[model samples]
Target: MRMQVDDLSDERVQALIMNHLESMALHSPPESRHALHFDGLRQPDVTFWSAWEGEELVGCGALKELGAAHGEIKSMKTDPRHVRKGVARQVLAHIIDVAKERGYTRLSLETGSMAAFAPARRLYESFGFTYCEPFAHYKHDPNSMFMTKEL
Candidate 1:
């Protein structure tokens, strides 16, 4: 698979993002749904990436600059058809590498606390992220699990 820094205007990338958001909404409660919509992903603070296998989009993820020295992971999703094929792992590893390259001291993320999100939490744990309090505009919520890793 090829991982590319994507322009948000690219049609294929946009489609992949839309698919991710829809999937999130389906599996996550409204209160726990943190996935960004298309316009949100295009914000100035966010850098997005897409993974492709041949001409097909396999997965995508984004990194959001929260402030000095901190970065937030966002919009991480693998195409359902490609789940368990290491697509999410590849995208996440790439995002972490990019965060380190950009001089970020820490990386944090907010994911659902529901059983449906077990795989996501496991993935972060495998990468050395540990449970933490909310780090950004997020407040205490039972529906959310916050994790952070020092780079």
Candidate 2:
């Protein structure tokens, strides 16, 4: 798959972002859903990437700079047809590599606490992220699971 920095204007990428938001709403309550929308991903601090296989979009993820030495992972999603094909893993690894290259000493993420999010949490764990208190503007919430990894 080819990973490219996205401008969030591609209809394919927008559709996937909508699907991701809808899935977040279905699996987690409104207040607990932290997935960003198209506009949200366009912030100066956020860098969005889309993975493509041939001419098809396979997955996408984003990295948000939280501070000089800290970053957050956001909006990770794989195309339903491509799930379990390592689309997410490749996108995530790319984001991590970028974070390290940017001199970030820590990377963190917020995911749902629901069973539906088990695979995502497991993926983060496999990358050496451990449970941690909320970072950035997040606070304690039963529906949210926070994880962090020191670079």
Candidate 3:
């Protein structure tokens, strides 16, 4: 699969993001869902990437610059039909590489603390992410979990 920077104006990317937000809503309460919308992801601090197998979009992920040496992972999602095929893993690896390229020393992410998110938590763990206290503007949330890794 090839990964490319996404402009967010692409219809396919928009659909994928919509699916991501909808999925998060299904697994977490409104206050616990932290998925960003198009406008949010389009912020100057965020770099979004979409993975494709030829013409098919397989997955997407983003890294948001939190500081000169810190970043946050956002909007990570794999197409429903493509789950378990290493799509998310590939995208995550790419995001980490980008963070390192940008000279970020730490990368963090937030996900739901629910059964539906167990797989995602395991995936992050495999990537060397460990449980951590909330960073950025987040607080202690019973339905949320924060994870981080040193680059």
lDDT of 2 by residue, 1-151 (tens): 9999999999999999999999998999888888988888999999999999999999999999999999999999999999999998999999999999999999999999999999999999999999999989999999999999999
TM-score order of candidates, top first:
2, 3, 1
Candidate 3 structure quality by residue, lDDT tens digits, 22-138: 898888889888899999999999999999999999999999999999999999999999999999999999999999999999999999999999999999999999999999999
lDDT of 1 by residue, 49-112 (tens): 8899999989999999998799999999898889999999999999999999999999999998
Error of 2 at 28 (Å): 0.9
Clashes of each: 0, 0, 0
In candidate 1, stretches whose alpha carbon ends up further than 4 angstroms from where it belongs are none
For all candidates in order, the CA lDDT equals 0.90, 0.96, 0.95
- For each candidate, give its TM-score against the true structure: 0.94, 0.99, 0.98
Better of 1 and 2 by TM-score: 2
Q: Lowest-scoring 10 consecutive residues by lDDT in candidate 3? A: 24-33
lDDT (0-100) at residue 53 of candidate 3?
100
For each candidate in turn, give its C-alpha RMSD to the true structure in angstroms: 1.3, 0.5, 0.6
